[model samples]
Target: MRIPGVPPAELAELNRAQDRLSFVYLERCVIHRDANAITATDEKGVVHIPAATLGVLMLGPGTSVTQQAMMLLADNGATAVWVGEQGVRYYAHGRTLARSSRLIVAQAAAVSHRDRRLDVARAMYRMRFPDEADTRALTMQQLRGREGARVRRCYREHAERTGIGWQNRTYDPEDFDSGDPVNQALSAAHACLYGIVHAVIVALGASPALGFVHTGNERSFVYDIADLYKAEVTIPVAFDVAASGSTDIGSDTRRAVRDRAHDGAILHRCVRDIRALLLQPGAAGPIDEAWLDEDAGDDTLRLWDDDGAELASGRNYAGEVDF
Candidate 1:
């Protein structure tokens, strides 16, 4: 899957750090390898996508990517997601970045502990409402009440400003076409946000099901994270697009959502916020010499030999520790 013409050192560097490219949206395109670059060809023209620098690739309906192009994306740590119309509905996703599992272990430990889970939930609420003096003390019920009120107010304000008729937030998953343009646009915009947040969650090696405020679903954590930016990002865009009376509201909504994500630096903020919420003060400390030294001893568990053969010699018997 290695691209030719690119030096090994440069490829190594690209894999080692985050890429400058944030997100790319493509639809009805054919992606394949073109020498050292991954090119996407459509009716418009053929364009090269710097897979190494890309954060997320949204493959909308009708997109066909070659196996070579997919392998290149995985090798470069870029996430590829198959989505529905206007990148609103997520269908599937590619491999995540291969990174340390320590962060995920820490997250699991926190969520498994009952009190710690509540604390994490409170921390999430505090993050969403930093100015509220009682955020830390508010119970989960209180937090939910406040969040509901706040969101309703946001909908009302946006509706008044944009002159779009506002009603209760409603959508039928079974019938996407049933909703009005505004409701449909909102659904589309939120789906895009979820896709972006899902990529970050996977990149960090965190569990999407292990959420703080949201639970029971596979993308519980994705929803929890996406909610933080909905007010500032998708809500306004949905309202504005609906107000414009555009024929293709979904496409317009996607463009606006992408623009907001870039302008607001939402991905960077998401990374920082995730760390702040999960890696709280004193929850875990820096790795020290002792931690590294544990792996240096010969008594360390070895499951396989250098030649890929299973080694049963290391198993401990009734009274003896085999080495």
Candidate 2:
């Protein structure tokens, strides 16, 4: 769900639509899909399509497309078509579909970036736990003494878990050392969990790649959300399960861990924190003291602190609508 080089505000507007049938994330392939005589085509080098409304989604270079299933999408008045690795150069009937796709891309981008603050927290969580901490606390020269030491302690505790390895930490991607069985297993598990996060984000009508904390290169905001639960959920569960002699992330174990995370209050706490951050008067844009009272509806919604105390009650939305 990443289309780089596009403006966040424009993307946010498109995402607010609740009735769109489907969206495309064509970052690597050219795609085409059709529904009710409406077809959209996404081509090379274009992150936002400016044509067609409902027919086809064409993927070229640097793009991706997602749907529950190809047949399902087509039946639902949509089509998912890919043009392979080399990328597509031409389509049978191009202009019409391309125009529609542009509009779709705009709307999709807006929806995807709707929750920037949640994106940030999720990314922070991922970079900190469950995914091996590559940097040693003591080794980071810039870190203050106490901060460095505390980070190291946490890192060591997390590193001891199974499915935690030292590939990115110690070796280059081109190096053969990355093939170690332990590292491979860790990578595989992390990948599966990442996918689960992506599915969750998609279900929530949120973008999976755009993030508040991580750079654009990572292309996995969902991975960030999954990372947040690492310390609070994934890492602990993984270590305990593995310590008991289970190594693989079998379907049952994966489901169990996911359910535990879902039911756990920590994630909710983090989400609430994120929501509050979003509600901050000046967080989205500039703060307007006069508009605060009128912006947030009175008593219709209430936000409690960790101790369950009311904070602020005035709505001050500015930049874009909340989804």
The TM-score that candidate 1 achieves is: 0.82
Candidate 1 structure quality by residue, lDDT tens digits, 1-323: 87674332223355422233446788898999775567989899999977776778889888999988887777777788888876767777877563455556667888888777777777777667767765656688998998998899999999999998888899986666788989988998898889888887776567878887888888888998899999999999999999998888777888888888888888777766666566664322332433322122233334565787745665555565455
> Per-residue error at 207 for model 2, in Å?
2.9
In terms of lDDT, the poorest run of 10 residues in model 1 is 292-301
Supply the global lDDT for candidate 1: 0.75
Q: Which stretches of candidate 2 lie over 4 Å from their true place?
A: 1-152, 158-189, 218-220, 247-253, 265-323
> Which stretches in model 1 have alpha-carbon errors above 4 Å?
1-12, 15-19, 282-323
lDDT of 2 by residue, 1-323 (tens): 77654232222223211223222324344333333232233443323332222233434446434342243333333333343221112221111101112222332443356454433343343234425442232222332343335445654576665445433323223432344433333333343344434333332333445555444643345454555555456545544443455444333244445455446643334333223323333233433444322123332345456886855657654544566
> What are the lDDT figures for the candidates, one per model?
0.75, 0.37
Candidate 2, 323: how far from true, in Å?
36
lDDT, candidate 2, residue 281?
A: 35
Q: Which consecutive 10 residues in model 2 have the weakest lDDT in total?
A: 91-100
